[model samples]
Target: MKAAVANTFDSILKIEDIAKPKIEPHQILVKIHACGVCHTDLHACHGDWPVKPTLPLIPGHEGVGEVVEVGSAVTHIKNGDRVGIPWLYSACGHCEYCLSGRESLCLSQENAGYSVNGGYAEYCAAHADYVVKVPEGLNYVDAAPLFCAGVTTYKALKVSEAKPGDWVAIFGIGGLGHLAVQYAIAMGLRVVAVDTGNAKRELAMSLGAEYYLDFKTDDIVADIISKTSGVHASVCTAVSKVGFRQSYDVVRRGGKCVLVGLPPEDMPLPIFNTVLNGVSVVGSIVGTRKDLEECLEFVARGKVKAIIEEKKLEDINEIFADMEKGEITGRIVVSI
Candidate 1:
C-alpha cells in the first residue's frame, strides 16, 4: 500500500510503501479512488492543534473509494459499494450527542487523519457504520470533497438558520465557501459572496451568488448593509481573524453568525454591539453522518457541486504548500 506518511511535525509528507490496514469485525477495507486535500490535512502535517496526530499518520478524510472487503459484522455495506470515509471516523453510539443526532460532539469520537489513519493512501479501513455510501450519480473526484468541504459548508448553512428568500453572506469564496454559495442558492437564500480577488468574485457570481464583494476594493460591511440592510445570516469559512470579524459584523440584527474555519489565533468580539443587536455567534464543526448523506444527495440531485482539480497522490506535499499560500481556486482531489 503506497501512503503519504507524516513522520514528524513541520516536515514534508513522505510517500512510503506501508502495509495495508487490516479491518476489525465491524470495519471495511476500501480501495481509495480519490481523496480530497483539506486544510486540516496541512494542519495535521504541521501538528497545528494542541493534540498531536499519531506519528506516521495518513492525513486525509475526504476519501471516496470502492469497498474491496467487508468485515464479518458488516451487513448493510458490501463489496463494490462506493463509499466515502469522512472526518467523523466513529463515535460512541451510546453517547448523548450521538443519540440526539449531534454525534460530531461525541466526546469519545475518533476522527480520520487525526486520531486514526485516513485516506491519503491506496487502501484505507473504516468502521462500516461510520462511512457514507456515495451516490452512484456522483463522480469519484466530485464526491471526494463533499465528504468534508461540502458537508462542512452544508452543515454551517443549516446552523445559520437562513431561510428561503433570506439574504446570507458567505465569507471567503474558496473550497467550502464556493459550495456554501451553491447550497445557499439551492435553499432559496440570496447570497453575497465576499473575497478579495476579481477571479473569486467572478467565480461566486457564476455559481449563482446574487452579489459579489471584493474586500480589497470596497468596504464590505457598508456594501452588504446597502444591498440588504445586512444579511439574515452569515457563515465564516475563512481562517483569518479579519474574515471572522467581517462575518460577525455583517449579520442583520438578531441573526446568526456561524463560524466554520479554524484559525490558530482568536478574534476579538465586540460585546456591546453584539448584545445590543441580539446577534448569535456560534461555531459549526464538520457534519455528522446524516449531514454527510444529505450533502452527497444534493450533489447527486444536481443541486450543488464541488469545483475540483484532480492531482496524483504523490503531489500531497505540493498541495499543502499551495493551500498555505492560498493559491488553490477550489478544492483539490488526489487520485490514488
Candidate 2:
C-alpha cells in the first residue's frame, strides 16, 4: 500500500510503499476512499502535539471508506459496509470515564493518526466497536471531515446547554468554525461569527450566521453584546491565547465557554476575570461513536454540509504547506 509517511518533524511527507496491515480478530480492514486533513494532523507533523508521533507515521483520522474485509470476531460490520473512522478510536471499556459514557476522556485511550497508523493510505484497520456507519446518502469525501469537525462542534454545542433563540458565538470562522455556524443555525440558535478577515465573515454569513464580525476591524466584545444582548455561550474553535481571552469578555455572566481546540501546553488563562464574570470554562474533545452517527444523520438530511477542497494523495506535502499558512478555508479532503 502507498501512504504519505511523515519521516521527521517540520518536514515534507514522503510517499512510500508499506506492507498492508492484516486485520486483527477485533478489527476490520477498510479500503480508504477519502481522508480529511485536519489542523491536528499538521500539529502532529510539526511536533506541536504533546506526544511525539512515531517517525514515518501516517497522520489522518477523519476517514471514510468501505469495509473490504472483516476479522473473524467482527459481526456488527460486514463486507461492503461504509464506515467513518474518527479520532476517538477505542478506549478501555472498564475505565471510570468510559463507564460513565465519557469515553473521550478515558485515561487509557488510543488515538487514530496520532498513536497509531491512520488513514493517509490506501487501506487502514479500525476496531469494529468504534467505527461509525456512514449513511448511504452522504458522499465519502464530504463525510470524511464530519468524523472530526462535525462531531466536535456538535458535541461542544450540546455541552453548552443553550436552547433555541439563545445567542451562540463562534470564535474563528475557519474549518471548525464554519461547521459550528451551520450546526448552530440548524439547532435554532442565533449565531455570531467572529474572525479577522472579510472573506471569512462573508463565508459565515452565507452559511446562515445571524451576524458576522471581523475581529480585526470591529470591537467584537461590544458588537456581540449590543446585537444579542449578551452571548449565552461561546465556542472557541481557534486555540490562540487572544481568542480564548476574547471569548471570556463577550459571553454574559454565568454563560458557558467551551474550548475545542488543542492549544499549547503553556497557554495561560485569565483566571481572575473569568472568576469575576461567573463564567464556566469547559474543555471538549472528540466525541463518541454515537455523536459521529448523529452528525452523519444531520448531513444526510441536508441540515449541514462540510465545505471541502479535494486533492490527490500525492499532494499531501503541498496541502500541509498551505494549511500551515492559513491559506485554506473549510476543510481539505484528500482522495486516497
Candidate 3:
C-alpha cells in the first residue's frame, strides 16, 4: 500500500510504500477512494496539540470508501458497503459519557489519525462498529468532508440551541464555516457570516447567509448587534484569538456561544458580563456516530453540500502548506 507517512513532527510527509494494515477481529478493511484534508491533519503532523499524535502517522480522519473486507466478528457491516472512517474511531461503550450519548467525551476513546493510523492511503483498517455508512447518493469526494467538517459544524449548531428564525453568526468562512452557513440556513436560522476578504464574503452570501461582515474592514460585533440586537447564538470556527472573543461578545442575553476551532490560545471570558447576561460558553468537539448519520442525511437530501477541491494523493504536502498559509478555500479531498 502507498501512504503519506509523517515520521517526525514539523517534517514533510513522504510518500512511501508500506505494508497494508491487517484487521483485528473487530476491525474491517476499507479501500480508501477519497479522503478530505483538514487543518487538524496539519496540526497532527506538526504535534501542535498538548495530546500529541503518535509518530510515523498517516493523518486523515475524513476517509470514505468501499469496505473491501469485514472482520469475523462484524455482522452489521459487510463487504461492498460504502462507509466513512471518521475522527471518533472507537470508544468504551460502557463509559458514563458513551452511555449518556456523549461518546466523544469518553475517557477511553481512540481517534482516527491521532491515536491510531487513519485513512490516508490506498487501504486502511477501521473499527467496524465506528465506521458510518455513506449515503448511496453522495459522491465519494463530497461525502469525505462530511465525515469531519460537515459533522463537526452541524453538531456545533445543534449544541448552540438556537431555534428556527433565531440569529446565528458563523465565524471564519473557511472549510468549516462555509458548511456551517448552509446548515444554519437549512435549519431555519438567519446566518451572519463573519470573515475578511471579498472572496469569503461572496462565498458566504452564495451559501444563503443573511449577512456577511468583513472583520478586517467592518466592525463585526457592532454590525451584528445593531442588526439583530446580538445573535441568539454564535458558532466560532475561526482559529484566531480575536475571533473567539468577538464570538463571545456578539451573543444576545441568555444566548450561548459554541467554540469549534482549535486555536492555539486560551479564550478569556468576561466573568461579570457572562454572569449578568446568563450566557453559556461551550466547547464542541467532533460529532458522535448518531450525529454523523443525521448530518449526512442532510447532505443526501440536498439540504447541505460541501464545497470541495479535489486533488491527487501526491499533492498532500502542497495542501498542508496551503492550509498553514490560510490560502485554501472550502475543503480539499485527496483522491486515493
Query: Pick by TM-score: which candidate is best?
Result: 3
Off by over 4 Å in 1: none
Give the Å error, residue 133, model 3. Answer: 0.2
Best by lDDT: 3
lDDT of 1 by residue, 172-222 (tens): 999999999999998899999999887897899999998999988889899
- Positional deviation of residue 58's Cα in model 2 after best superposition, in angstroms: 1.0
> Is candidate 1 or 3 superior in lDDT?
3
- For candidate 2, write residues 132-189 as lDDT tens digits: 9989888899899999999999989988888999999999888999999999999999
In candidate 1, residue 252 scores what lDDT? 90
For model 3, residues 1-336, the per-residue Cα lDDT tens digits are 999999999999999999999999899999999999998899899998889988999989999999999899999999999999999999999989999999999999999888999889999999999999999889899999999999999999999999999999999999999999999999999999999989998999999998999999999889999999999999999989999999999999999999998787888899999999999999999899999999999999999999889999999999999988988989999999
Each prediction's TM-score against the native? 0.98, 0.97, 0.99
TM-score attained by model 3: 0.99
Ranking according to TM-score, highest score first? 3, 1, 2
